[model samples]
Target chain A: MSEPILDRPRPVAARRDAALPEPQAQDPDLELVDRWRDGDESAFASLVRRHHGRTFGLLVRMLGSREEAEDALQETFLNLHRHGHRFRREARFGTFVYRVAMNAALNRRRSLGRRRAQLERLASRQAAGDDLPQSPRGPEAGVVQGELRARVQREIQALSPNLRGPLVLYDLEGLPYGEIARVLELPEGTVKSRIHRARRALRERLIDLVSESDDESEGAGQ
Target chain B: MSLRLGHRRFRDQLSDYADGQLSPRLATRFERHLASCADCRKELGELRRMLELLHDLPAAEPGPGSVDALLRRMAETEARPRRWLSAWGAPVAAAAAGLAALLLVQDVSVSIGLPGSAVRPEARSASLVAAEARALPRRPAPPAPSTAAMLGRRAEFAPATPGAPSGASSSGRSALAACIGSRDTRDCIRYHWMLDLAGRDVPAFLEVFESLPEAARPRLAGDLADLARGSGSATAIADHLRASRDPRAATLAARFAAVGRR
Candidate 1:
C-alpha cells in the first residue's frame, strides 16, 4: 500500500495541454511537417524541439527509465528524419510523432525483453530506499509518494501492450481516443473498451493503496 | 441511499462519468443512480482519487541538449558517404549471415536440434491470443504421406484438429500484413519465410518448421492463429504442437499460405 493522493503532484505534464485540439481539425503541426518533408532541416529540428519533451515524458512513463527513454527519444527522431517523406496527411504531426515514439519504445522494450527493465527499476528503488539514512521521525510523505509512483509505474508496466498502449496514450499521454485508436491500429470502440478495462485492472491492483490513502486522509482530517 | 438495487450500470461508467465523456442522457441516468446508491458514491470517489494518484506521477523533460543531440546524430548520419549502407548495415549483415546459414538449411542435423524445446514467449501481443489457442485440445499427427515431412517425420501428417479449415480459407498475405503491422521485425521475417515456404515449397517449409525449437511451434502456431483471428479467418491451425502437431504442420504448410497472389 502507498500514500493517498491529496493534491496534484505533476511538475511538467508537458505532454498534456489544457485544451487538446483534435488531430483532424485545423492541424497546426502539418505545416511544419510539410516543411520538414520539403527538406528543411530546421523544420525537422523545430518539430523535435517542440515535441521532444512531451515524447520524452511519454517514454519515461511507458519505459520507466530516464536512460531508456533518452535512447528511445533519439531513435524516434532519427526514424522521423529518415522517414519523414512517409508522413501522411491523415494524422496530425503530433499524433504521427507520438506513434513513432511509441513504436520505438515498444521495439526497444522488446529487445531488452519485456517487464525485465521495470522489474530492475523497482528492485533498484528498493535498494535505494534501504541505502537511505535511518531517521528518528517516521519516514515521510516523500517516501510514500516515491513508492506510490513506483507502484503505479510497475503496475502500468505489468499491463500487456495492447491494453497498456491505449491507456498510456489516452490517460497518461493525454491523447484523444481517436489518435490512440490510430496509433494502436484498433477501432475507437475497441480503444475505449481497452482503456476502461485497463483502468479497472489498475484500480483493482492498487485498491489496497487507495484504501490506505483514504484511511490516512480521514485520520489527518480528524 | 438504497443499497439493494444492484446499480452496477452506474458503477461501470464511473470512469467515463468522472471524465465527463459520457452522453448527457447516460450521465443523467448515472447521476440518478448515484443519488440512490451510497456504494456507487464511494466507488466513484475512490475511482476519481485513484485517477488523481495516477496523474500525480511526474512528467519529465528530455534534458538539456537532447533535441540538439538527436539533430547532431542525424546530421552525422547524413554526413556518412554510404548513408543507406550505414543505416541498413546491421540488417544487411544479418541477411548475409542468414544467407550463410541457409546453405546449411538442408542440414538435417541443425533442423532436428530444437524440435523439443519449450516456447520462449517471444513477443508481447502473441501471449494473449496464444494462450487461447493453446487451450484447444491438440490432435495427434496421423501418418505422413511419403512425400511430406518436418525434415524428421515418421510419415504422418494430420490437418491440425479434426475439420481444421484448409488453405482455401486462410490467405498468407493477410497474415503477413497483420504480422508486419505488429511491428516485430523478427516475427515479420519468420512470417515472410514461413509464408514463402508454405506456399511455394512444401518440403522447405517442413524443414524450416521442423528446425524450429519445439517451444516456437505453438507460439508460431499461436501467432498464426492470432493473425488469423485478426483477419476474421476461421481456419487458423493454431493448436499444432511441437511433437504430435507434425500432421497439423502438413495442413499448416498447405494453409500457412494458400497462394502467392498477394
Candidate 2:
C-alpha cells in the first residue's frame, strides 16, 4: 500500500479563478466578442490570444497529440468566427467557446480512430517511463515527480473519451461541475459519475503499478 | 466514528473528498470512516496525488501562425457564396436525365422486339405518352374522345366535356408537389404518370383501363393505387369505377381500395 502524501485541499473557487483569468476590470471577453460580431478583426485576434492557451491545452489532452490539437484549434476558431453573430448574450462567452472547442476536439479524436491506439502508446510509454515532459537537469526529487507525472498522464490517456474529457475538465482545469456540464452538454449527475469513474480508473492503474514494482523489488532482493 | 462506512460508499466519496467537493455532512461521515480504515486512507492519499500530477502537467502552447492561417481560411470562405447549382445540382441533373429518357421513349414509337411482342403500336404510343406526361412539368389538354377515337388513339386521352373539374390541369400541380415531396424514385414517377393520365378526364382513364389487355393490368393497378393514395377525389373516382363489370377495372379498383386502407 502507498503511504499518505501530506497535501492540503486547495480552495476550489480560488483555483478556478487562478486557472482562468476573469475578463479584467476594463476589458471584458464579451466586449471582444461584440467587437468581432461588428466586424472588428483586431478584436478577434485579442480573443484568440486570450483564450488560445487553455483551449489549446484542453484539445491537446483530449486528442493526446499536439498536431491534432492544432488542427482542432483552427476549426474551433473558424466556427466561432463564422457563427459569432449567432452567439446568445444570455450565456457566458467563455463557456460557449469552451463547449465549441470540446465538441470539435472530441469529433476530431473520433474521426482519426486513434483513441485505442493512443491509449496503447501511452501505456507502453508509461511502462518505459518515457511519458514525462522534457526538463533540464534538476534535483533527484524532480526526477521522481516527472515519473509520477508520466504515470498519471498514461492512465489519463487510457481512459475512454467520455470519462477522460470530464476528468480533465474538472481535476486538471478546476472547472465546477455546472460549468463542466455546459462544456460537455451532459447532465451534472452524469458529469459527477464520469469524474468518479475516471478517478477510480486512475487509482486502480496506480495500484497495479505499485504492486508490480513491489513484486519486482522483492524478487531482486531474494 | 459511530457508524462504519462500507467500501462502496468509501470509493464513491474518495473523489469528492480529495477535491473538498463533498457536502459538510457527508465529509464528516467520510472523515469518521477514514479514521478506522487504513485501506480507505491509502486510497484517498493516492487520489490526491493523482489530482496533483494531472494539475502539474504543463499546458500546451499554440504554434506560431495558428490564428493567421485560420483567419485567412475564414476570409476565403466568406468570399464564396452558397449557390443553387451547388445545392440542387444532383436533382437537376437527374431531372435532365429523366427528360432525356422521355425523349428517347417518344422517339422509339415502333413496336419493341421481344419474345411474344404482340402489343399494338397504338398501345406502345400510349405508354410513351404516359412516360412523356411524367417527364413534363405540366400535362397538356387532351383532344375530344370522338377526335381521339377517329385518330385511332385510346379514348381516355380525350379532352374533357364542359362542366367537369378538368382533372388534368386541376391535379397536375398537386401531383407534381407530391413528386417533389416524395423521396422514393419509383413512387414519384408513378404518381406523375397517374396524375397526367387522369388529369384530363377521370372517366377517360377508366375507358382506357377497360381496353388494356391482361399483361398491362398490374401497372394499371399500381397507378390506381398511387392516385387513390394521394387525394380524396381520386379515391372517389376509384370507388365510382369499382362497380364496373370489366376485369381490368375490377383489378384497378381492388388496388385502389387496398391502397386507400393504408
Q: Give the chain B TM-score achieved by candidate 1.
A: 0.27
Model 2 per-residue lDDT tens digits across residues B1-262: 2234486777688777777766777877777666667567766755665565577787777777555444433332322222322432222222222322332243321212222233332223233233333422331332344223312222232224332212233343354445445534333433443343443434545554444465765775675566546654455445554644445556565666677677
RMSD of each: 20.4, 20.2
Candidate 2 achieves a global lDDT of 0.56
CAPRI-wise, candidate 1 is incorrect
Native-referenced DockQ of model 1: 0.15
Candidate of highest TM-score: 1
Against the true structure, what is each candidate's TM-score?
0.52, 0.51
For model 1 the TM-score comes to 0.52
**How do the residues B39-65 of candidate 1 rate in per-residue lDDT, one tens digit apiece?**
555566666656877888788777775
